[model samples]
Target: MNGLLKKQFGLVLMLMLLAMLMYACAPDEAPVDEGGSSDEEESSSDEGSSEDSSNEGSSDGEISGELEIQYFVGGYGDSWWKEVISDFEEEYPDVSVTEHAGPNINEEMRSRWVSGDPPDVVYIDGAGSSETQMVEDDQLMNLTEWAEGIELEDGSSLVDSFIAEPSTYDGELYSLPLVFDAWGTWYDMNRFEENGYEVPKGFESFMSTMGEIQENEDIEPFVTTGQHPYYFSRGMLYPAFAAHGGNELLADIVQGAEGAWETEEAEEIMSNVEEMVDAGYVDSGLGALNHTQSQMNFLLGDNAFIPVGFWLPNEMEGDKPEDLQYGFIPSPMNPEDEPMAIVPDLRPLAIAEEAENPEAAKAFVEFVFTREYAELFSEHTGAIMNLEGVDLANNENVPEYLIQANEMINDPEQVEIFYKPHPMSADLETPISDSLVSLLLGNITAEEFIQEAEEAAAEYREGQE
Candidate 1:
């Protein structure tokens, strides 16, 4: 079997076993008889479900009732959710918490979101559903005032608790960013060092270096997950945004300003991609490879580099190279200056505006930043939380690669920072990804790619009107 299929089959089987195991050892706690009717009892048969454990006390009434929590079960998993919910239950004895999580948790929650019966708290990650779209549609809560003066046990407001405050649009806070996904070009340091390859810093020099390496060694310099070509575009797009014009250009493109995608600055970015394709640096088999196959091929020396996230180590934990020596570099955007690393802020947690239990959702969000919750997050997920001053270096559960990545980005002297996202509408993301993929596969020209994207953006704006 192919690498991706093998891995997927294993995951499916594992999840099946996990379901059976959990069922055998599952706790059957009766619902808390809250005098009134219990919403918790009714939601137990949900698509992704965990029963709200029966709890004592609760007359304090700070924030009571069922907290409908929806979260993505991706690389981070759902263990952290269970840990934090237990903490929330302890803190607010009157409240009942349940877990509703799956790989497609966000997709499953869509009908509820539209019907104004959304979960109190939702993890705003993954594709299809977007926090930005939700904000534009006026379906999200404005957390501005709540953020300014939330009381924490440490006597600091919630605004002061984070390393960086959540992203805002129009001076209104609508979502809270929790998880950090660092994207870049990944390589094997041992192979590079052994082969005496100096990391190239500029786009022109990087292309030259790839040419020289191809001439001298058996190394195939670049490969992208071909079946999912978006993986290649995902990392480089941000640096390209910064190189062309940064936020000013990003705003124009996102707002669907006329001719924004056709500018010379934008062309510079796509042309570089074309140059790579023309030089034959891209893998021929790139069109057939899935993410797992590509990563495995990368490790096996079939290719020298791949575009991936910090979650690489976790994903390939068992299959990683011995003496790993992993290294990362930003996609070179310009010929002269050192390329800026693309560190997009991710908002994984948000409270719905029209939640059945809004106060409880806000309380749950506030409770997430506390020391207990942060440590549990690191311990289970190994993701670098935005909560500052939590030293997780000694935590056994924290992956070593994550610790290295955390230190690399936190030190400002390392490289320039590109702080913006794609800023394109949700509808355009896939089309643009496809366009880039097509360019690499020799099916489309760079100009043709941009034209296709611009056409899609125009359609999106017209529908918005």
Candidate 2:
């Protein structure tokens, strides 16, 4: 009996040993690979994400929608615009850009808006009736909301400059600044140098230079249009105001603050224009001539200086000789102040409120904001991009002096938004642009002009209330 029990115990021990061996040999739990290998997988995933982001830069050459864009016939039909639109259509096969061009864009827009079929986007140059009216009637869409939350590839915010601020009302953006056609004087460098005269800096210096020209040379020192009547005010009056104390004085006047207009500063500005006319520094033909003819006279060397802006270059395209050394300078003022000033007005692109293709309109606006388009538009317009990182080259038409003038205006301290904030009136602009003309023509005394301007401003302020 003892022998049989011992044998049974040995058999049980053997079975236990075999089970232990099997457990030891069973794959040793395969020592699972730790996070070190997983790092490779993570890197691959990151690279894929980076590639996806790169693909999203400025949208691929793929667009498929029907688009209708309306531009001023004056600036349309350029090679760059043609190429851009063609490329856009090729990318977006389904999209079509049908341009409606005419001399009376405002009339066309007004009719279209009344007919309830306004184009997807309409351009405004401060000439299209009233921007405030459009906003109040809800005929224009608020662009602020559309522009928000959209970021460029480098994650920069889109267009922080308030080029459209004056047009904004009640803290809402109604339009986007398509082009900033700032105003200044165009000079003939060769004529100035030949006459042994330097471009004047301030009011005193400017008049002295003109006086020298008057005494030594037979050419009129400055020539501008009188019928349009706004040129002198913009090129002469506003810049003078800026030289005195920047936009503060004009702002006070527009806002009807204490002692705004009728100040010595305002009188000085009027006197400057009057003195030019009285001294025969302005063309004798100025009172009867229109803007085009005035510009033509300058191109023909009958005049030495013109009060104009960037569009002058384009308008004189064929008329101006290739070697004509044209230059632009800021309106001369007192040297005690900033050397130059910028009058910020916008040529805006607004989406109609009742647009049928709101999505497409938004898409087109984004396309316009793209760097590629901005660069082309800047070069073609003979203007620089308000947006950064754009490629630009100054031609002979845009002389070095003009480029310097542009730079000075772009300087932060010298730039000011023209017109008053929300409570301001377009009616005020009419008077300022008109009264200065009357002052130049000697029809109204400087005192009378200021008084009339004050009254007009008061009426506008009351209406705003």
Candidate 3:
């Protein structure tokens, strides 16, 4: 009886051991919920759902919305915009981007702006887009607080990375300058080399070099668009003003101060221009040509030099001769001992005051200002971004001239940068552009130019009142 009882106990122990082994090897069942479904069953159902998985990896795991972006497609084109937007969408997978972009996008979107339903982000450039006007209309959000502390991908402060600060009104930032453009003189290095012409550094050398070009080459010495006289007024005249009397004179002139246009510095610069016209250095037929025509003429070697922006090469890219090596120099209006002055034409990026997707808009703004994007910008547009520390020299795609120009622009010893406190009003710029045309054509003397400008400025101020 004792042997039989021992055998029973052994059998019971073996059965219990087998049961535990089977339980450990088998998959555990999830606890049932009140809805008659287990957690694992619900997870399996959701695994096949495309909608539920779409928000994965979104910004903060929550930034899902439609982001509307407006950009001007000019010399820079829309390639950069398209690529950046694609990259942005990938980073924020749940966000859908709608682009309002084209050469005439600014005008096409004007009604929306007027209706107070502007795009979340706007690239303030091309025709019909003015940063100052937008700010005056209270259309842009104040980016001061957010921009001040925002960190870039490399951990640098966003504001600190800008080559130039965002324009501020009463210490409040509204727009961020995205494109860093400066008006300067452009030439063909290959032509210069073939002709043995030295690049001018100052006023005296400029005259001498132009004289050589006129006497030797079949081309005119210099050419600018008389139809768009601001090419001369802003490119040459503004830089000359800054070089002559520093940024103070430029500020005064831009502000339309009473005698700003009538200053000795202004008179001297205008006289120098008049001298160039009198010497036959300027193209007499320029008045008949628009901006592109004038630029094309320069490319055809009809002129040795032209006053324009860095956008020149890109604007005329398709028409450029394969051998046309680009060369750039600041206006060279300064004295030999003085550094060349740069009057930057900054194109800003802003968020609308009523942006429905402010978070996404802010994220887009921050994404664009990185060093990586700056390099990409140079590659796509052959132009510089406003972001600092971009190494374009090592970029094989960028033209040699642009690389050299960037070096000169960033070197304090080589250039002195300045800007108008604000963009000149159309009322003021129109008269100035018109007078500049007259002055360059030798139809008006420097004195008359100053007097007319002062009168027009006074009239504008009175009208403003």
Most accurate candidate by lDDT: 3
TM-score of each: 0.79, 0.76, 0.84
Model 1, residue pairs in steric clash: none
TM-score-superior candidate, 1 or 3: 3
- Candidate lDDT scores, in order, read 0.72, 0.65, 0.84
Give a tens-digit lDDT track for model 1, residues 420-443: 533355666666667777898878
Give candidate 3's TM-score: 0.84
Candidate 2 residue lDDT tens string, 1-465: 999999999999999999999998887333324655355444443453363432121233333334566666453225555676677667654455666545466777677788877777666543445565677668888887768765554576666533344356667887776666667778788878887887776667677787787778677877889776666766666667766756687566545564577788877776676777677777766788888899888888777778786777766678986657877766775453545555654566778888755655666666666566666665566654446654343344443543665566656665443543432345666766677666666676777777888887777677667
Task: Give the backbone clash total of model 2.
Answer: 4
Between candidates 1 and 3, the lDDT winner:
3
Query: Positional deviation of 34 in candidate 3, in angstroms?
Result: 19
TM-score pick, better of 1 and 2: 1
Q: Pairs clashing in candidate 3?
A: none
For candidate 3, lDDT tens digit of each residue in 134-220?
876799999988888788778988888888777777678898889988889998898888879899888888989999999997556
Q: Which candidate wins on TM-score?
A: 3
